[model samples]
Target: MSKEFEIAREFEVDATPEQVWDAVTSGTGGWLWPMEAPEPRVGGKGPFGSEVTAWEPPHRYTNRVEDVEGISEQTLNQLDYTIEPRDEGRRAWVRYVHSGIFVDDWDNQYDAAGRHTDFYLHTLRQYLTRFAGRPVTAFATFEGPEASSAAGAFTAVARALGLADDTAEGARVRAEGPEGKPLDAVVDYRDPYFIGLRTDDALIRFFGRGHWGHPVGVSVHDFAPGADAAADEAAWKGWLNGVFSQP
Candidate 1:
């Protein structure tokens, strides 16, 4: 049997394939995924210094990757992105396939691939959804002696969600802790906030500080016309709960 494994993930974004393609081709766009950078042209730089093997505009892009940094001889790998139009907007599918020898175990590689796929798709969805019609925004609040730490945490979270470098407008942190302080940070579409710190540990603390108001508030536009705030909240809560449930 071939020692190759493949992992794929799909996401629905409220934008046209061209828009999604633009995001995928943008400098900040590639950062949302595992690839270091993506050059649109064939034979151009791809993930991990690989070369683009295929380029089909607004639809599919494929690259040939290699492992040229060790005892392992150069091997061939492939990463592909396919976009399809959907009723709401566009559906994007990213597929990764690896072939060749494996010194250790392939299980870890598979696990990592799965994680990366999930994170990338989630980030893409979040970015395209938030920036679908309006400019991107970053909302943050800080507390405790580690205000910078909190701000850093928020930034890290934003980044993981596909926000770019200039998206943030610095930290609007408060002087006191959660109980006695309030802070806010907002960023535009051209400059989106990308979270860079450890946020999983401070989830409850962050929410308790009343900073979830804007970030978690889903727009009514995402739902049907008759949908109310309660329904929106419930849907968002479910989505968030599902995300947190992931290992």
Candidate 2:
């Protein structure tokens, strides 16, 4: 584990620095990943067992996450986020960096993290733009075959569901599962990195990234009030398992 691997991404956000700060700090930032952290400051606890190492509001923040032991043991994992004002207070720019040491497999681990980061950041933008300030019921889960074994399964599932390789945002999508049930959902968002679908009841997001490449996760955000999130989670779990299980 002498060498370290890094993954970095940059994004332009359509919000003020103060607004982006709140979105990443106090507002719906935690909701983006369903993790809790203490207030942003030095020595504060961050999501995913990370501890805040540096904090500068409306500009920069960084954390070092706990060593991940499973799926081949990684060490010294650090995440840094930098936000800069843009468009004369109408927008902001963000840079995200994830660096770590892997004991054994470096390429697989790095690629998985890269893909996951892309999806998470996209979701953050979606939250800030469309769903900000709205109460949301979020449900997330993981599936099997590990990333190592299922490297391309994410795209496979999309193709199996009849989505073209060029399916992008605003594309009308329709497909059927192994059980002969139709998936009548629109392409709310799509990219080589990920795909998001919006049904009448929920917004479903699927990502190619997974822990060790084994999982192709689907997140559910119900739009209706008093929605049974637990039940929705269970239903999606079953439905996705079926969709991904196709031959």
Candidate 3:
């Protein structure tokens, strides 16, 4: 059965509205997945090869998607962003709306998509606060084994990284890197389904999808110049395999 869904978020970023505009419209890779650079104008090609429905620089932008690889055309997706600059500070208030129609597994898909929406927006705040204007130099993702699809799989990895369940945002984190090195970061965002960390060089996200009956995974968004994404992916893959007890 097909159903309509809406995931909405409103947050403040420590950057100008213009900066937020640049990030979402041009620098999606810093917090979200790598995407083709969006064409800059109304009626131009937007992300996901969708058409730009509305455009008002540094303030409002909207896109509609009717074609997604491997998805039914019964689905229609739209991303709308509204940015408002603060009166007295270098901050911006952003309202993001992602409304669409889902044709398969509506309940499960909505749950997953809702949790992911919060995490992605949190990462956007982290990117603007810490790595503003810096392009994503490297990006990689790794998934855990199916055996790791338990409700506590993400917490298990966090415990291995030396964090307790009570860890709070802004806490200093010292975790073992994939290459056996010490990684120092701060807990930027944390919740039952996700842990977000910001290091000097990267934003790391640990997913607790197992909570929703999906395989847990992680993604690294490196901002360090000349970072090697392929190597990072390989190292994290091996590390995650070990965490999930994959042979």
Best by lDDT: 3
Expressed as tens digits, the lDDT of each residue in 1-247 for candidate 2 is 4458888899898877776667666633223545565457789887767788889987888888756645344467888889999988789899889887866566776777777777777767766666655656545555534431366677776876688877778877776533556878778777765687766555677766543544766677765577766776676667667655556
The count of residue-pair clashes in candidate 2 stands at 5
* TM-score, model 2 to reference: 0.79
lDDT of each: 0.43, 0.68, 0.85
Per-candidate TM-scores read: 0.48, 0.79, 0.93
**Model 2 C-alpha lDDT versus the unseen true structure:** 0.68
Q: Give stretches of model 2 more than 4 Å off.
A: 27-31, 69-74, 144-152, 159-162, 174-193, 198-202, 209-213, 244-247
Clashes of each: 14, 5, 0
Q: Give the alpha carbon lDDT tens digit for every residue of 1-247 in model 3.
A: 8899999989887899988998888845998888876678889998776889889998999998884655777888999999998966488999999998988788998989888998898888888888998989999987888977986788777876778889999999787877567789998888888888889999989998887788888899999989989988888877877777843
The full ranking of all candidates by lDDT, starting with the best, is 3, 2, 1
Q: All candidates: CA RMSD in angstroms?
A: 14.6, 3.7, 1.7
